[model samples]
Target: MLRADPCATILSPRTSLKEALERLDALMNRLVEADQTGAGIDPLRVAGELGQIRQLLAEAPAVVRAKDGQKHFRCEACGTISHGDRQPERCPTCGGRKFFAADIEQPFVESGAG
Candidate 1:
């Protein structure tokens, strides 16, 4: 028996991300069913699926964005932070050459209520 393409129904005028997820889930089930039917799987289809999943994850929204304020460059040695567009040539505190762009920006906050 030929397996039906679950993705055939995924195409529409207003296909949302949620709909795509549902279609992908159905396709996975179909692929699993096809595997148990004693037929060799299509390598190209599997490769395409892997690529799709990678792209989906890459585009997914990050959960840590709420906590992380912004992105800034931080010094590796003295732990000094710089909000410039690029890392400084030398650290002001320790004068170190090593620097990295921190995924999270934690600027010093003063609490005046105390």
Candidate 2:
């Protein structure tokens, strides 16, 4: 019997962030159900789902920033971040040619509400 991929629905290119979040929520509900009912959910499958959730959360910010058009690039050799629509032919800091799209992290701001 072939096992269905747990992430297949959420990993699709056309899946929206909202849909992914809903799917993850459903998965979490399953985990909670198993815990409460003493169901025999496979440990390995649980671990794999958690791992995938972690990865998706980690990548979500970058994906959102890219979709918003605030594209960035990082130099593989020197860890320098450059902002632009395309990667620099050569990194300004290290003159490295290879570049990977990266996310520009926004600075934190305090609301001053005490």
* Global lDDT scores for all candidate models: 0.58, 0.63
Q: Write the per-residue lDDT of candidate 1 for residues 20-96, one digit (tens) a residue.
A: 45666777787787789775567677666656655664454332222435445556655566655567789877688
* Model 2 spans with C-alpha error above 4 angstroms: 1-10, 62-114
For model 2 the TM-score comes to 0.41
Residues 1-114, candidate 2, lDDT per residue (tens digit)?
Answer: 453445444354444444555667777777787799896577777676667666664555442255557678866665567777777899887688987776645545354787
Candidate 1 residue spans exceeding 4 A from truth: 1-3, 6-16, 65-114
How many clashing pairs does model 1 include? 0
* Every model's TM-score: 0.41, 0.41
* Cα error, candidate 2, residue 36 (Å): 2.0
